[model samples]
Target: MGISKISEFDCIIFCVYAVEYRTVSGVAGPLVILEKVKGPKYQEIVNIRLGDGSTRRGQVLEVDGEKAVVQVFEGTSGIDNKYTTVQFTGEVLKTPVSIDMLGRIFNGSGKPIDNGPPILPEAYLDISGSSINPSERTYPEEMIQTGISTIDVMNSIARGQKIPLFSAAGLPHNEIAAQICRQAGLVKRLEKTTNLLEGGEEDNFAIVFAAMGVNMETAQFFKRDFEENGSMERVTLFLNLANDPTIERIITPRIALTTAEYLAYECGKHVLVILTDMSSYADALREVSAAREEVPGRRGYPGYMYTDLATIYERAGRIEGRKGSITQIPILTMPNDDITHPTPDLTGYITEGQIYIDRQLQNRQIYPPINVLPSLSRLMKSAIGEGMTRRDHADVSNQLYANYAIGKDVQAMKAVVGEEALSSEDLLYLEFLDKFERKFVAQGAYDTRNIFQSLDLAWTLLRIFPRELLHRIPAKTLDQFYSREAASH
Candidate 1:
C-alpha cells in the first residue's frame, strides 16, 4: 500500500514519544524506524515513516553529506531500518487544532491521547498561530474570584486576564491549580477542599491545561484531581513528560495555546489556560539552544529567553470583537527557590500579576499557601463590583493591607525596642497582626465564604487595631465597618 526506501545517518537524536498508533484495518501497525537522508540543509531534522504507516518527525544530530543524521520524534519501538522511508517536509513542525479538540486530551505534538476517536482531518487548524495584534486588544478587567480569601483579598485574579503561580518545589501549586480550574466560573460557591459544583453553570468556563516535562505519576495525579473534582468534562489537557525528548516540552505550550485560541476566538468561548512548571520548559529551551550551538545568556539560558516566554505568555487576554477571551495561569518552580531565576523573572514582566505560594505559609498548613503582600493583580479594580462582590471590597482590601503592613512594622520595632517598653494599647495592637494572618490568611480550601462574609471577617480582625492604623481606608469607611464587639472580647 506504500512505497519504501533505505537510508543511513551519522547519529540519531530522539524526540518525544507522543503516542502509539494502530489502525482499525491494520493498515498501519505499531510503527518505529531509524531512517535518515543525505544532505546538509536537511542535516538538522529528518522524517522517518514507520512500519505502521505513521510518519515520525524529528531533528538530525550528527551528519556527513553522504549520510546525514536523524533524530526520531517518536520513540523507536517496533520497526527496523531497512524498510523505513525518510523524507523532508522543509519546515519546522506544526500541530493541528479545531473546536473538536475541546473534550479531547492531546500530547505535546497535538496527537490524541485518549485514543477514543479520531479527529476529523478537515477540521484541523495550524497550531502555530501568529501573534495577536496589539491594537485589537482590550483591557482584561473582569475579576476571577477563587473564593480563597487570600487570593480574592490580596492578589485578586481578574477574569479575562493572565496571572501565574510562583511557588517552590513540594508546595501545593498543583492543588491550587486544580482548585481554580474546578471553581472558575461554574461553582456558585467554593471552599478549600469542597465545591458546590451542582450550583455552578456547566458552561461557565472552559479549561485548557498543559503539563510540560511531567512524569506518569504527576500526570495521573492531575487526571484524578480533575476527574474527582468534576472538572474533567469541560477541560482539555496536554501532557509532555520528562521521558519525552526535550523538544516536546518546547512545543507543548504552543499547542495548548493554539487550541485555546480556536475555542476562545472562533467558538466564542472564554478559555482559561493553565501551565504548570514552566521551569521545565525553560530547561528544555536551554538544552535545545546548546545543541544548536547558540550563545547563552543568564545561567546558560537562551538570551532570547525573555522574548521566548513573552511569545507564549502574551497570548493571554481579551481581544476586541472577539466575544471570548484567553486567560492564563502558568505555574513555575524556581530552581534553588530563587525568585530571580530567569523563568520567573521574565514571566513576572510579561504577566499582569503573580500569586506567590510561600514556604512559611505552607509550614503553617495553609491550603493555598499564598503570600499576601508580594502577590498582586495589576488589573484587579476593574473586575470587582460593589454588589457582585462586596460594596466594600475595594476599601476593605486596601485597608486590611495597609493595617497589616503597619502591624508588621509595629511588631518588628517592638521586637527590637522591647514589648514591655510599649504601651498596653500598642501591645494589643501588635496582637492584631498575628490574628489577621491566623484568621484571614489561613483557611481551608473547602471553607466557603461569600464576599460579605469575608469582608465582615476582615472587619472583625480590624476591631483589634486602632482605626488610625488603617491609612488606606478613609475615616468614613472605618465608621461603616467598625464592630462594637471590641471591648467585650
Candidate 2:
C-alpha cells in the first residue's frame, strides 16, 4: 500500500492507495515496462511518481500476467526506470462532463487550458465509450443546413448521419470547418410560408469541435472566429497542438465524443461534432503501434485501425427514444489527394457519404471549392422534400447535377476539339456551365443562405437551358418556377 499526503490549512491528510510498484524495468518511447506487477487491468490509469515528487499520467496498454506495458500521456522523456513508482488506480481513464462544458476550451487530455474555474462535473464518463447498436438507432430524417449552397442544395447533411470532407494537404479545409461550425443548424420554416423561423430552446443545437495536430496559429484562428461570430457560447473546443505529447492525439477525439454524448443524450441538445485533420489522429496511432513493435498493416498502420475508427464513427446516431442526436462530420486530408489511400478508403466504407474539395476550383480563387459532382449525402433523400426542406429540393438537386455533368463533358470535348466545331446546342451547355460555376457554386466567406434562397438560385441557373432540355424536373415544378421571362433572358 502507498500513503499520500495533502496539506491544508495548518493540517495534513493521508490517503491510502494500491501498492506502488517501484520496478519500472524499461522505458521506451511513450511506453514504460513494469516488471513484478500483479493484477494490472488493461486501460487502467497509472500514476507514475517521479524522483522530484511530481507525477505523470498513463494508461495500461497491455497486461501479460505479472508484467504490464503502460502508455504515458505526458511521454517518458524524463522517466527513470530505477526510481519511478507506479500506482494502479483500478479505474479506466474518464473525463468529467456537464452542460457547463459549452464555451469551454480544453486540451487533448480534457484539462482546462483556458483561464477559468474548474468544472463541477455532473458525471465522469469513460473516454472509451461503446458504439450505438444498429438495432436501437433511428433513421436520420432531419436536414442540417450548413448555409453553404453546394452542401445545402446538392449534398444535404442529415441529422444523426456520419459524413466526411475528403480534402488534400493544402486545401482550405480548416476554413471550411470553421464556417460549418458558425453556420450549421436545423433550420425551421414557418407553416405555409417560405420565411425561416428561429427554433426555440427545445431545439437545443450545439457544436463539439476537436482539432488534432494543429499549430498554435490555426488554433487561435478557430477561437477568434467562433468568438466573433457569437458561436463560442455554444461551442466546446478541444485543441491538440503539434507540439503537445503525440499520444494525446489518440485521446482527443474520444474525449470530444464523450462530451458530445453527454450534451446530446443527457441534456437533450442536438450536437454536431466536427473532427478536423483525422489524418493526424491516424498518424499518431501509427507511431504508438510502431513503439509497441506490433505487426504493421497497410502503409505501416496498425491492423486494427479499422476497428479503432469504427468505435469513434459508430458513436454518431439517434437512439430509438432519445430526444437529441449526434451528427458527425469527420474531415481527413488524403495523402497526395489519393482517395484510395488507406485512411480515406476505409473511412468511405464506414461513413454515409463524403464531400470532396476541388483543387481546380480553389486555384480559381473559389472560397469553399466543393466539387458537386463527386460529393454526396446518402441520407439526403430521406431528409428533404414536403415537410423537411422544400418540395422542389430533390428535383432542383437532380437537375443541377445532370446539367453540371453534361457541361463538364462538353468542356472536356472543347479542349479536345476546338469550340468552333461544336454545335449550337453544345455552346448553350458550355455557357450554362460557366453561369453555374459563377452564380451557384461561388459564395463569400461569411455569406449565409437559407434553403429557399438556394433553391431559387438553382432555378435561375436551370433556366439557361430550354424548357425542353430540362427533362429531369417535373412539369408541375417547372410551371411554378420556370417563368418565360427568365427562360428568354
CA lDDT, candidate 2, residue 181 = 85
Tell me the TM-score of model 1: 0.80
> Deviation in angstroms for 202 in model 1?
5.6
User: lDDT by residue for model 2 over 26-53, one digit each (tens)?
Assistant: 8878889999998999999999999888
Q: Show pairs that collide, candidate 2.
A: none
Model 1: per-residue lDDT, tens digit, 1-489? 886554585466789443222211111112222223334353234566667787667654444444444444565454465455565554545566666776677787778888768676434554557777889888876556565777776667665788889998889888788777776662222223322232224464788999998889888888888878777878988988778766678778988988888888878887889998799999987876775566999999999999889889888888899887888999999888899989999999999889888998799776667877888888888766453354467888887777677777788889888987888767766787778878888776656554445666788887776776666777765666675753122
Q: lDDT (0-100) at residue 380 of candidate 1?
A: 80
Q: Per-candidate RMSD vs. true structure?
A: 9.8, 5.7
Q: Go through the candidates in order and give each one's C-alpha lDDT.
A: 0.72, 0.89
Show where candidate 2 strays beyond 4 Å: 1-17, 189-203, 484-489
TM-score of each: 0.80, 0.94
